[model samples]
Target: MVAGVLEVDPAEVTDESGPETIPTWTSLRHLQLVVTLEEVYGLSFAFEEIRDVRSVGALRDVLRAKGTVPA
Candidate 1:
């Protein structure tokens, strides 16, 4: 999903992948990713969570905390 939003190959998306590593992960794409995750998971994120996610690992942590993804 991250790769799709970033318009990158899936293999390029590592846990550390984010704006720093993936040039396509612009602010607009970040919002798109947040909305997509909310819709797909049937859950919403806090403003802080949305603002704090800077990496794939961080996003995964948020999802796991919300019980949307396995720990």
Candidate 2:
């Protein structure tokens, strides 16, 4: 999913993957990504939660903490 959003190889997307780690992960893409995740997971992210997501692992953590992603 991260690879699809970033337009990168799926192998390149891991827990460590993020904007800084992936060159294709532009700000615009990040916005689109957030929207996509929200829609796909049927959840909304708070501003601070979004800001706190620095990696795929972080995103999962945030979503899980918010009860968006299942445990």
What alpha-carbon RMSD in Å does predicted model 1 have with respect to the real structure?
1.4
Top-lDDT structure, candidate number? 1
Model 2: lowest-lDDT 10 consecutive positions: 62-71
lDDT for model 1 comes to 0.91
Q: Write the per-residue lDDT of candidate 2 for residues 1-71, one digit (tens) a residue.
A: 77788899998988888888899988788878888889888889898877767788888887787687633
Residue pairs clashing in model 2 are none
Superposition error at 28 for model 2 (Å)? 0.8
TM-score between model 1 and native: 0.94
Give me the displacement of residue 20 in model 1, in angstroms. 0.3
C-alpha RMSD for every candidate: 1.4, 1.8
In model 1, where do residues sit more than 4 Å from their true spots? Answer: none
**Local accuracy of candidate 1 as per-residue lDDT tens digits, 1-71:** 88888899999999999899999999999999999989998889999999989999999999888887733
Highest-scoring model, TM-score: 1
